[model samples]
Target: MSIEKIVDQALQDGYLTPSMEAEVGRICNTASELSIEEYMALDRLMGALLTGEVVVLPRKQFINVMEELVLSEAISQAVEIDKDGDQSLDVGDIAAYALNRLPPLYATTEEGAQYQRSRAKEELQSLIASQVKEAIARNLDRAAQNQTVLGQISDTPLLEQMNILLKAYAADYEPDDESEPSTPN
Candidate 1:
């Protein structure tokens, strides 16, 4: 059976929910067609998943991927003419290096492909930022609820209380701070 079908069957049998199966399939497909770098990323992702650390999932993988990308680029840049007078590191060779280095089964649309070609890392960064933001929002909501019930803080003070909690969160964690910087120095 196709991998998609396998996932579908898992859902019908109550082994996996629709969302769980989708996440599994998405990661599986990406890992399956991966390049050397992408393979490393996916493995790191799996390690995080196995440990119940969703925040660290793609992040660990990204660190590996970025390292590989830098190392490979450096190696390619260092290539020079050999004794036989042949220039090293041709485009076809680099293309092959890249072909095996990205996740498999990326969604396709002319626009999406163009976006991928133009700013691939941008998309990944956006996804990571979105997830981080979602987690923060969820935690903030939960904290607000708890503070209201336990501390007897008024609902009118929710915004202020959330900010205080968020400040504490920022102190403890390196939040995904991708927001635009201030204009003044």
Candidate 2:
């Protein structure tokens, strides 16, 4: 059902009173007042929905709440323990852990939850850096188009900077991790 429909049903059932409804509406809007803590709360909430995390926002509150409120969050926390028994806490690991620990309003399983964040893990593990360099190689063609635009319009400062940045990036860019390219390629 649509969110407004759900809201109406909630109001009719006395779950969301008029005042509470308005407050929730504002929360749904993602007003600037949502603190960093609240941002984390919502991310956890919505993520629960994905990994079977939070069920209240249930199947759809995900889009509803995020539309109004920007679904921003802390820059993730990480924990690094190499095979040698050294441990460190970084941002992505922290975020993932927090997501895993979300209360039942979100989901039912942690394994599922972890998979839901595979992209974050991919980024955290630096797996994407290999792909990033290759993508840059392919998209470098567009740099010329972007350069054309920059040179055209009264020289927008950011565009000019972007041109310089892309050229420099293409020149000295080194991927932190480079996967062995497939022989077929």
Candidate 3:
């Protein structure tokens, strides 16, 4: 029997656990630092997986990190598309960037081409959603932290009021009693 058949049988028999899958994914991640071209190739491979033409069970973490890397690079490219020092991208800019960055799918029929275009746009939109949410969350967290630090350091009336309120609040909570006179007596 061929090695492929043996591996297939092993997988079918539930011999491949999550740990093994994670280890394989980690190894792949370490070995291949995927560039834009490689990202496109991986997307094509994902098409096969989506269509059930190929069966792959990569670790969730690995898939997430891979998608993050691709999306980060794509976003970076999109942001850099306009060098006007605007520092932000509009929806049309992002849409155009996605269209340009993604690989073209050539189909013989118009319907097939339209289907491929829709699929590509849908996938890119999903990527945008995940990446944009994460970016917004990180930025908001950082902003909140900076605001607190600034309030504490700046000599402003608001900081003074906050400090007074904090001290009052702290005064309300007494330390635990440390008396041991009864035991000693």
TM-scores for all predictions: 0.20, 0.22, 0.25
Considering summed lDDT, which 10 consecutive residues are worst modelled in model 2?
A: 63-72
Q: Residue 150 deviation, candidate 3, in Å?
A: 2.2
Scored against the true structure, residue 13 in model 3 reaches a CA lDDT of: 54
lDDT of 1 by residue, 1-185 (tens): 33444434443453444455466567667664745654554465455446554332121111234323333443444342234344333433443344344443242455654555445455554443333334334444655665655464457577887776666556566546686566886
Which ranges in model 3 have alpha carbons more than 4 Å from their true place? 1-70, 77-120, 123-134, 137-141, 154-185
Best by lDDT: 3
lDDT of 2 at 14: 34
The residue pairs found clashing in candidate 3 are none
Top candidate (TM-score):
3
Select the stronger candidate by lDDT from 1 and 3: 3
lDDT of all predictions, in order shown? 0.46, 0.41, 0.50
Per-residue lDDT, model 2, residue 75, is 25
User: What are the per-model C-alpha RMSD values against the true structure?
Assistant: 23.3, 19.0, 15.8
The deviation in Å at residue 33 for candidate 3 is 40
User: Predictions ranked by TM-score, top down?
Assistant: 3, 2, 1
- Ranking the candidates on lDDT from highest down gives 3, 1, 2
Per-residue lDDT of candidate 3, residues 50-95 (tens digit) = 6665565554431222233345645665455446444344433334
> Residue by residue across 26-74, what tens digits does model 2's lDDT show?
7668665756665564454445446542223223222222111111232
